[model samples]
Every structure is written in structure tokens, then in C-alpha cells.
Target: MKKSLFSKVLFVCLIIPSVLTQAAEVNVYSYRQPFLVEPLFNVFTEKTGVKVNVVFAKKGMAERLAREGQHSPADILLTTDISRLVELHDKDLLQAVDSETLEKAVPEKFQSKDNTWYGLTMRVRNIYSSKRLGQVDLSYEDLADPKYKGRVCTRSGKHPYNVALVSSMIAAHGEEKTLTWLENLKKNLARKPQGSDRGQVQAIHQNLCDLSLGNSYYFGNMLNDEKQKVWADAVNINFPNQANRGAHVNISGVAMAKHAPNAKNALALMEFLVSEQAQQMYAETNMEYPVREGVAVSALVSSWGQFKADELSLETIAQHRKAAIKLLDKAQFDL
Candidate 1:
């Protein structure tokens, strides 16, 4: 009887390592392009011996998660924009992360109130102007100025990026004022609101419009591209309202999936993503600002000079998303 008990104990010890080894992996569902994120995962794997498996998708993450329910394999969801993260929370596709590391690394303004999502990096919604205009200083509110009528260009107001911008507007100026701002800004469009942010820069290059709104990273990206560098050269990147409330900002962020099969490894990955090593990689590789203070900005990104970002809580801006969309529709913004 004693020999049998000893054998059972030995057997349990032998299997535990095997189980732990098999469990040392995290699965990810990423809305971000693979090229943009794979390197960070590679480094995390090197450091922790935890394998990361990614299923890249352009859309439908929410629907997929809902369908998969409690059996979903995805442990982490990496996505861009506040609304996307908020959508996951509202849909109950995410679970709260109670990591002290995350709470310390990310600012309260950039994380969900319930700690379900944490911002990884930041991008400014900058106003770009033709060099001919020479260092234009304007606020997001100034886009409505009749003086610039028929001289501004932008992507669809309904695009998530612009929608976030409009939400910030509503937070700053309230519904009625933001709607009027949207209508007047629409009247200033050089052509119909159209094309990608790059296309708006191209409009400035071609002299079709004198100013357009675009994310700050697009400037660095355009400068790196062979064809787009010329377009990048045509404009000066402006961080608006520097003297007042400061420029509006947005983020690319991550969340812990509701049904994470590799729960421990998933939490580890989330913690690593906010680590100094990962934050630095994001800044250098993606031309974005690290959410963690003290991570260095790339030289090219730094050359554009620094400006204050509006410190309003992202949670507050997200609350205004529906209102922003409503005003856009009521104003026939894209039309």
C-alpha cells in the first residue's frame, strides 16, 4: 500500500511539468496588421518562452468572439481606436485585467474605467497645411472658419479616426456647438470628404486643398515611402490649439479576451505589452508615442517638434461617440 501511494505521488509530479509546458502559450486575435505587431511578440517569446499564436483579421472580431462564446481560443485582442476597445467591453467580449503592472504603466485617461482595455501607444490628430500657408496655427474648432472655405480636405467623417476626433469635439464644446462646427467644416471642404489620410496629404501636394486633418504618424510614414515622401514634403504638420486645450489624441490598444484559454500566459503578454521594452519597440517601429513615460521617440518623429496633447480622459470622449455620429448624419457630413 505504501509503495502504491509513493508511485502515485511520483506520477503526479511527472505530469505537472508536461502540463505547464503545454500551457506556456498565448493566442491573439489582432485587428492590427501582422507586420506591425509580430516583432513585439517575437521579443516577448524570446524573453518568456511563451509562444504567441496570432490570427490576423481586418474585421468581425466581435462577431467571431460572440459566436465562439466560452470556448474561444483567443487570449488577447489587439486593436486600434477607443471605439473598437469600447465596443468589445460593451458587447461583453472582454474581461477585466487586474494587473498592477498595467494600472501603473498606463495612465488613467487612456485606460477603460473598468480596466478592461489599456492603450498601448498614442497618435495625434494633427492639422496639415500646405507649406505655402507657412506654419498655420489653428484649433480643431478653426476648421470651420469661412476664411479657409473651399480649402480643406479630409477622409470620411464616419471613419473611426475622424469619429474619435468629433467625439473629442463634443466633449470639449457640447452637442449643439460640435454639430455647428461639423457643418461649417463641411462647407470648407475643397472637394467632397473622400480618400485615405494619405490622399488628403496628396491633395495638398497637388494644390487641391490648402489644409487637411490627419494623424501625426502618417507624416513619418509618408516620409518613409518612396512615392509618398513628395506628398509629405508638401505640408507642415500642425498640432492644433497648442496655446489652449492642446491637440486631440487617440490610441492603438489591447484587451484581455473574455474566454482566454491560456489565461495566465495571456495576462503575462498583456503585462509585457506595457513593459518598457515593448513600449520602446512600438515607438521606434510604428512612429507612435509610447503610453509609458520615458520611452524615447524616434528621431524622425521628434524632428516634427513636440506639442501638448489634450489631457481629457479617453473614457469621457468615448461616451460622446454616438452623439458625434448623430451630428455627422444630421449634417450630411459626407455628402
Candidate 2:
């Protein structure tokens, strides 16, 4: 009897650790860069004793997830831009999350109707003008005014950032009007749309154009970088259409993988992400607006001051993306 009891005790000890080890780690497939998320993940691991395993990729996450199917080890998907999140949703790659924490912290407009995803941070699609031009007050509609012809610059119209902006336009104004705006806005371009958002700031600095469109976080990002500061300094960040619908906004968000092996841990991490501790940390890390209300933005972001964000639902914006792309093609905006 003593020998049998000893064997049973030994088996219990071995299995407990095996189960604990399996339960303590969660895997993630992130489109967000390591530098942007490493601190948050490190803190989470320290607090919860759950290891985070990550695979970083610039693109093709959907295809990979589809290929992996049920065998995929990914418990969570972290990515920037609503377009990517919507893509994953459309592909049925992510599972719905029904967390009271997320629902309470993330505004309804920033999350999916069914809660498949939730925004972690927000950024505005801002219109930037040259200081040489003085403090110019304008709206998105003003970009197409003949008065500003040959004075505007932007990245490609088809880029996801711009696509979302165009979609917002469609939501605000019907398709016909938006298509006309696109054509006129194209006519106003100082040059063919090309390059990244920062490149548009560079163009403003070089006097290529007096006005351009860019994401608000790029202002903070540029100010932090020694070389880019000059380009940032050359322009003033303007939140367009404060008088109307407010500035267009987008998000960096997260979703649970459909076949998450460590689902419970993923849910815990998801809840932690919306907690004030993680919200403030993540906002500071990315130089973005926290999705959680009442969280203070980083000092630099605060310096930019606050503006009313257009409260349009992101799901509505996602619904209009196809039409926005069609308008871009119709106008030959990039050409």
C-alpha cells in the first residue's frame, strides 16, 4: 500500500507541471512590429506568468492563418489598421470575444458589432500644412478647392489608410459627391501620389506642396526622431473639419484567432489590454490616443491638443471600403 501511494503521488506531480506549463503560455501572430509591442508583452508576462510567443510578419497573415487552419498555434492576432482587422474578420479567421472589460473600456464605435475585435489605440487622418503658409484652417472638402490647386500632396489613394479616409468621405457624403471630391482632390495634387506618410511631410518641407494629408501619430513619431523632426517642424498638424463631422480616425486593434489553443489565456490578455494599466502603457508606447476613455495621452500627443473625433462607427467605414475603392478607380486619383 505504501509503494502504490508513492507511485500515485509521483504521477500527480508530473502531470500537474505538464498541465501548468501548457496553460501558462499563449501564442500570438502579430502584424504589429516587435518594437511597438515588446514592452506591453513583457509586462503582461511579468504580471500573469504567462509567456507570450510571437511571430512577426509584414503581410500575408490571412493566407497563413487559412493554411494553418485548426492546427495554427496562434491565440491572438495583433495588427494595425481597421482594414486588416476587417479582412481577417471577413475570412472567418478570428473568433468573437464577449468580454465585459473590453465592452466597457472600448467605445462601441471602435469595436465590432459582434465583438470579434476591439481597438487598442486610435489615430487621426490629419491634414498638415506648411508653416510657411501660416496657420491655415481648412476641412477635408477644402482639399479639392481650386484655390489650393497644385498645393496638396498625399500618399497613394489606394493605400489602406487613404482607403479608410475615402470610405469615411462616402459615409459623410454620398458616392457621387465623394467621387467628385476625389477627382478634384486629384487635380489639386502637387505631384502624383507616392511614398509613405512621412514622405508627404518631407515634400512639404521641400516646398513641393504647402498642404498634405498624414496620420496624426506620425507627427509625434517624427518629432521623436532626430532627422525627421525637421520635416515635422516644417509643417503644422491640422485636424480637418472640426466644424463638421470632426477628423477621420482609424485604429490599431486585436482579435482572437478562431482556433486558439490557449483561449483562456488569450481572453485574460485581452482583458488586461483594456485595463487602465495596459491602455496607458500602450498609448505611450505607440504615441497614440488610448481607446479607453479618460486615459491620458503621452505628453507629446497631449501637446498636439485635442480635437473632436468623428464618431462614425468603424464597422460602417468597413462596409463602405469597396465603394471607396471603386470611386478611387473611377477618378483615376493615383494617376
Candidate 3:
């Protein structure tokens, strides 16, 4: 009986460590597309020996996390746009992180003041005008001018991208001025606000409009596709507000879940992402500017001349989001 008991105890001991190793994994709820982030995670796994498990969704991961509450299995949340990141933080779904590596890598302006989130990449909001338009220089304010009436194309004002831009306008100007600007911009739309940023580019190609607003990376993505390359070729990217506060910019960022079960692995992955090697891979793969200083942008991205990014803190811009949305509705922007 004693011999049998010893063998069973030995088996249990062997199984337990393997189970613990498997449990060392980090779980990610990501709004970013899988292709954009999987390569970085693979490298993280190879370096740290801690596995990454990602669940991707196009939307509502934040709500899902909130619903999951303290019992949530999510260790980290990866998403694009400052709006979504701020939304997660505002919902109390994210926890503050204290990582010296992240602090050193990311700029103060690009990270949460409370350290709940950090930006991974920078994407400029640029105006794409038909090459036929011939060297038109414009600012965000100029979009509302009567001269450009009926020449603008954009995605829905309700989209997080547009909302963030509108929020910035509210920050630079104010509620009343922003509201008036929205009304004028609404009048300037060639058609009802519709489509993705790429779709707006397509509109410019079709001569439906002479100008559109889009993130810089979408142009790079389009250039990679044979069919879409023609649309990309048709427009010249213009960095708006070069003379003033600088062009509006946004980020793709990540946060830790408030009740992360694998906090150590999650923090490790977060730190790894901001490291020089990972930032380079991130910039090259996504065709975005790395948030970490001195990590070079992709060669293709470099071909586009650099312009000053707006210096406004994202937290200040986030505060105006509600006001921006209200202004959009009041202007009947999407309607």
C-alpha cells in the first residue's frame, strides 16, 4: 500500500508544475486586428516563455470586460484610437501600471497621466486631396470654409476617429466655435458622411469629392493591394495645420485589465511591446510611427515627409468627446 501511494504522489507532482506553466499565460482582449498584433506576441512568447492568448473583436470588448468585472480573465486590452483607450479607463476597467521600461520608452504626452494606458503607435490624421486639385495647402479649420463647400468626404462623424478629431477641435477652439465649425463642415460634405477612411479615398478617386480625411497607415495598407493602389495613387496626402498647433494625431494603445489574473506576464508583455526591438517590428508591420522615441518608422512611412504632431495631451482631448458628439448630432452630420 505504501509503494502504491508513493507512485501516485509522484505523478501528481509531475502534473502540477506543467499546469502552473500553462497558467503563466496572459489573456488579451483586443480590438486591434489579429494580423497587426500577432507577430509582436509571437516574439514576446519566444523571449519570455510566457504564452499569449488573444480574443479579437471588432467592437464592444470594453463592455464585455466591464460585464465580466472582477472575475474577468482578460489580462490585457489592446486597441486602436485614443477614444477607445480612454473609454476603457473611464469605465474603471483598466488598472494603473508602474513600469520603468514603459515610462522610459513612451513619452509623457502619449501615456495616461495615471499610467493606466500607453500608446504603442502614432497615426496622423491627414487630408488627402485629389492630385488634380494641384498643391492645395489646407488646415483643419479650412475644411469648414465656404470655398471648399461640397468638396469634403469623411467617415461618419460618430466614428471614434472623427470623434477624436472633433474633440481636438473642441480643445483648440471651444464648444461654440466647434459647433459652428461642425455646421459648416456638415454643409461642405459632398455626400452624407459615410464609409471607412479608405472608402473616403475611393470617393476622391471617383471624383465624388476632391478631399477626404484619413489616417496615414490606411494609405500604406492600400498601396499594398493592387486594386486599391490606384485609389491611393490618385490623392496627395496633406498634413493639416503645419503652421499652428500642428496636425491632429491619434494612437493605437494598450491597457492592463483591472483585475488581471496573470499580472506579471501581462506587465512583461506590455514592457516588451514598448522595447526598441518590438517597437521597430510594430512600426514596420503596421506602417505607423513608433511611440517610442528613436525607433524608426517604416521606410514607406518615411517617404511621407514628417510634419509636427499636435502637442495637445490626449487626456484634455478626451474630456471634450461628449461635447464633440453632441455637436455632431446638433449639426446633423451623419444625416
For each candidate in the order shown, give its overall lDDT on alpha carbons. Answer: 0.93, 0.94, 0.92
Quote each prediction's TM-score.
0.95, 0.95, 0.95
Q: Candidate 3's error at 292, in angstroms?
A: 0.4
Model 2: per-residue lDDT, tens digit, 63-173? 999999999999999988999999999999999988898999999999999889999999999999999988877899999999999999999999999999999999999
lDDT of 1 by residue, 106-224 (tens): 99999998989999999999999999999778999889999999999999999999999999999899999999999999999999989999999999999999999999988999999
Tens-digit lDDT track of model 3 for 213-232: 99999999999989999999
Off by over 4 Å in 3: 1-19
Q: What is the lDDT of residue 7 in candidate 1?
A: 100
Look at candidate 3 and give me any clashing residue pairs.
Answer: none
**What shift in Å separates residue 23 of candidate 2 from its native position after superposition?**
0.7
Q: Which 10 consecutive residues of model 3 have the lowest summed lDDT?
A: 17-26
Task: Return the TM-score for candidate 1, rounded to 2 decimals.
Answer: 0.95
What is the TM-score (0 to 1) of candidate 3?
Answer: 0.95
* CA-only RMSD, every prediction: 2.1, 2.3, 2.6
